[model samples]
Target: MRKAAALGVAALALAAQCAAAAVPVQGYAIKATYPHDPQAFTQGLFFKDGFLWESTGQYGASSVRKVELATGKVLQKRALPEKVFGEGIAPHGDSIVGITWMNQAGFVMDQGSLSIKGTFNYMGEGWGLTSDGERLYMSDGTPEIRVLDPKSFGEQRRIKVTVDGQPLAKINELEWVEGQIYANVWQSDRIARIDPFSGRVLGWIDLSGLAATAKAGKDIDNVLNGIAYDAKTRRLFVTGKRWPKLFEIELRPAKK
Candidate 1:
């Protein structure tokens, strides 16, 4: 995730997108809340085997962590280089793959030990990342998301995300859930559920109530961001930068 939200991609942009698409926004009810590190400037997040894997940004504070979902315990972590800003991470095979901000350099790590194994390269500013067990998906703070080869990191294709033919820019913190791409519209309390094939936003998940901090004039940069899904149990979790709690939520119809 970039340190600051990009220009022309704020709450108003999201509102405009919603208006243009006439898309349905789903509300959510919190099923459970768990502890999260207040210091983690979460950029990437995912769930696997009862654990949450997170990547946090900030030049000096960047690190990749494996945390306990129940208590938010940092069971393992690997601090990134002091000058490199971590962006997003996805588990690829037996190794974990991650990208950095502005450098175009990505690294692979031993999944179990959290030690560096190798590195790869890509083009563009990395923002969010995820996988569909066969290929990888990456967002670059733009309206388009890139599909890359898992091993070579080569761009295979690009998906131009749109709502009523208007580009949904600044796509960040991605998760692949149920064969669809779930993305956080940067600095907005809206998550777009996109069809990977058509690039059309099927609907929006309104997190405005959960993102009350920004509305209350608290941390503006700490708006809604991260998303993770536990497919086995069909649990969806969402959180934000510096948030003290992570919530497991179930989507429900918006009230009239």
Candidate 2:
């Protein structure tokens, strides 16, 4: 009887995997294109109030900046210290919170001035970060996302990201868009649209061939890595590290 029950459970799990695998992969329509700094190794991005706030990576080259959307011009910038490699950033009330790659220490910047107001510490590596206006969602290069208190940046809970009942690794550069979490799968050209609560990958935005137009330099690691959405106008944008162009794209129906 015990052996029979174990086989039953395994069959049920396989059925779940098949169902999840049937989730559709989506395509996109390029609504518009704008210039981006090819030198900016984009790590995180958010759109607000007609401007783009971006966080860039690389040791001794990390920075947070406010850029004009139309011209790709950096209007305001603040460079991080040489010792820390920055990862992700999100806005919290009147400030912007930023996380580093491995230092486990993140900083809070005043939104109006881009000045470091304070610092906070966490337990593990920080890769990508986003905000839903209430809580902060942080990814640590694993399949799990840590839900954090926006005020204290304290870990409240975790959500394990999975596709077809399997873990999805190298999740990077997250953005909370229209109640769903859109994440870039590191080193891949596609983005995963995930359910924040269930941690289930609802679908994937297959962005194949989009990167070829960005005119990225010879750095082979400059895969797609940034996403930003404007809540006011509902415009979705995507780009890559050291990419020369940023695209405003509209989602089409999912493909088989």
| Best candidate, TM-score | 2
Residue-by-residue lDDT tens digits, candidate 2, 88-140: 99999989999999898999999899999999999889999999999999999
Angstrom error of the Cα, residue 53, model 2: value is: 0.1
| Cα error of candidate 1 at position 70, Å | 0.8
Candidate 1 residue lDDT tens string, 45-139? 99987899999999999999999999999999999999899988998888889999898999999989999999998888999999999999999
Give me the candidate number with maximum lDDT. 2
Clashes of each: 0, 0
Q: Give me candidate 2's TM-score against the actual structure.
A: 0.92
Give the range of the ten consecutive residues with the poorest summed lDDT in model 1: 211-220
TM-score of each: 0.89, 0.92
Total clashes, candidate 2?
Answer: 0
What's the residue-level lDDT of 26 in candidate 1?
89
